[model samples]
Target: MEQNPNKPKILCVKISSNQRFFILGKEDGFSVYSCTPKFSLLFCRKFQKTGISIIDILESSNIFALVGNSKDPNFTTNKVFLWDDLNQKSIMEIAFPTPISALKITTRFLFVLTKKKCFIVEIEKRSILKSFSINSPSDIKPSNSFDFSLVKRDSLHIAIPHKLRAKIFYTNITKPLVELTIKLNTPSYQLIKFNCKLTFLAVVSPSGKQLLLYDLLTGELYQKFRIANKVSKVYSMSFTQDDKIIALLFNNSIVRFCSIQLNETTNRLVKIENQMKNVYKKNLINIEDDTQGICEFNEWNDLLVIYLNGACYRFTFDEIEKKITDTVSFNYLNSKEVLESKFNFNIEKEDERKHKEGEETKTGITSDKLNENKNKKTNENIENELTDLVELLEEQKLEDNMEKEKGIF
Candidate 1:
């Protein structure tokens, strides 16, 4: 079969647990980008040899965990390199007996997922701490199967998928034990995510139609939300930095959000029906082709949905005006032209507005000069009518006086 040209060539995109830096692994090399103001491309560096398949970087740090693809058998897929970007070289390389599948990096430990085992390695000591068996269907699965979070700036709060449930483990390297486990109603999970604060664990079922939010501490369900309709499919879901709002992309077209409030005093997520009340279903972007996409929330609570084809769409939500504006940019990865992501205009709506303004101007309604001339002509007509009325009154008075003077007396 011939390959579809529309297919995206980007291999993988990994966002740091901090949500500040995200790396794009292309067929050639991986480049890091900053999600600060606009999703700006920091720099691009291509490899002279093998392509990078996966990348996991520590939060806002130059250290990266890099994995190469197995297209060339000579370049073993069983190795993960600890790269120092500032020095521009690999400082350490860790090789496993089996090919590695996925990786999650942190300051304390590096979580490596392999064929049938999950290995935990100490970053400082460069020693393997433990290995556990996973009954995952395949050797390699989506890297989202597990997520890492920091507790009190030291402990590691890890969330992973068990048979059909979600497991939460807490360890500070001093004490390791099972903290809590969330009994899930869904048979399988598509992805699991922990908010940056490590307070909430968001789990989406395999169907991606429903969302479950759990209290990371108590392992209790805060509330379940309906993300999409039965027929619609949710491709991506993300939470804002404040954790007060969550957004999701549906049917590769529309994007919607729900309000979530975490009570600080109670240390619990509030339950509100406003989520269903704000169920807006508008096609934010009608893609020409079907594709899987991912969504991210920046510091300003703006929603950014990205596709593998380097197509990026941003929706800026203005709380004061209660309005949303969007902008689209293409070929973001390879192009040097920056994404003018200032969402000042909605393309179709802006065009329609200009057209309406043009029609109004043609009819002498919109132009200020045309309005001034129209008001001048109206004032002249009113003055002439007032003068004629005064003249009629004077003529009537003169006729009355002549009748009295010529009286038959």
Candidate 2:
């Protein structure tokens, strides 16, 4: 289902985890639509009046957050508005001095990212809990990429990569815990992304030649993939909800999926399966002016490629192969109100909390060091020791969880 076919290009596309609805951001405004069964238009809300920069929705709730667009004359870009779609009312609004670089929300907290700092706010109270900077005063610059991970529900980790080094901050504390200095002499231009639930960090190089994955719990380099040198453009890579599979988009149209597993003897991350599928076979001949968009995987392990043409294709994966199961187009239609009964859907809260406890055993940190290392060192010498200490603590935690499970069974 293509929405407005004659409008300007679609800038961004994202799907909720429930797989029932998707959102598209375009030149004029944003639209929400029903995605399951068959593509059906829900409604397109124009921002010409207030101007929205971005929209974020919780897959399991009716909560949505809108950030003001700088280009709009009616609103300031530094403000964020929280809305409840089910109730059809705005909850609250907050403003910041600096422009928001990225925005994310969980049930308990709202995460706002700036070029050098991150702000954590309590959702219900509409008050700031904590805010911190990712860089020091001397080295700070406009950051192009920032990644956030909420580890074990209570701990938030933010990764900011710079020219020669990348800093990883455990936002639960005051200072950065680790600085991963790139050993290579090459000048850096790469983006970093984190699998928030799994605590796996992926870094992609600008030349699209090298990809690295790190396990935050063990502080170990999990795996490395040498992307084909011939492929000049690699957009992004992400881990599936299960953290066992990874998907990578190349040259804007072709997507590759790889399965990750632990080697039995070595207990190291390994790629056990690999497959590649081309999404735009129809546009293969027209490569120059090919429209580009974004690729994302929902909770069900389905890969969705939403293109600039307002076309969305979903690829479902099976043990044997992957297939394109559905295609939806969003064609421009006049603004209209959708009846509540026609599109009413329920998202069970249990579905969102199912894996919270078990996954913590795999990524949890020992609670013993929370006080010991809370305020000890601010020097550079502690960087190397931090990795070793973190790994030791994680190993201790696994042993403890195993003994407790043994007692239960």
Identify the leading candidate in terms of TM-score. 1
Question: Which candidate's lDDT is highest?
Answer: 1
Expressed as tens digits, the lDDT of each residue in 23-113 for candidate 1 is: 7776666766655445667665566566678788765545578887756553467888765443244545678888887898765578888
Q: After aligning candidate 2 to the native by TM-score, how far in Å is the CA of 171 from where it should be?
A: 5.2
lDDT string, candidate 2, 331-408, tens digits: 324335353222211222322312121121110111334223333323312223333334444454455446643111
Screening candidate 1 with a backbone cut-off below 3 angstroms (N, C-alpha, C), the clashing residue pairs are none
Q: What is the number of backbone collisions in each predicted candidate, taken in the order shown?
A: 0, 11
Q: Can you tell me which runs of candidate 2 are displaced by over 4 Å? A: 1-11, 17-20, 70-74, 135-144, 151-157, 162-164, 167-189, 196-199, 263-290, 319-409
TM-score of 1: 0.70
Model 2: lDDT equals 0.51
How far residue 132's Cα lies from its native spot in candidate 2, in Å, is: 2.9
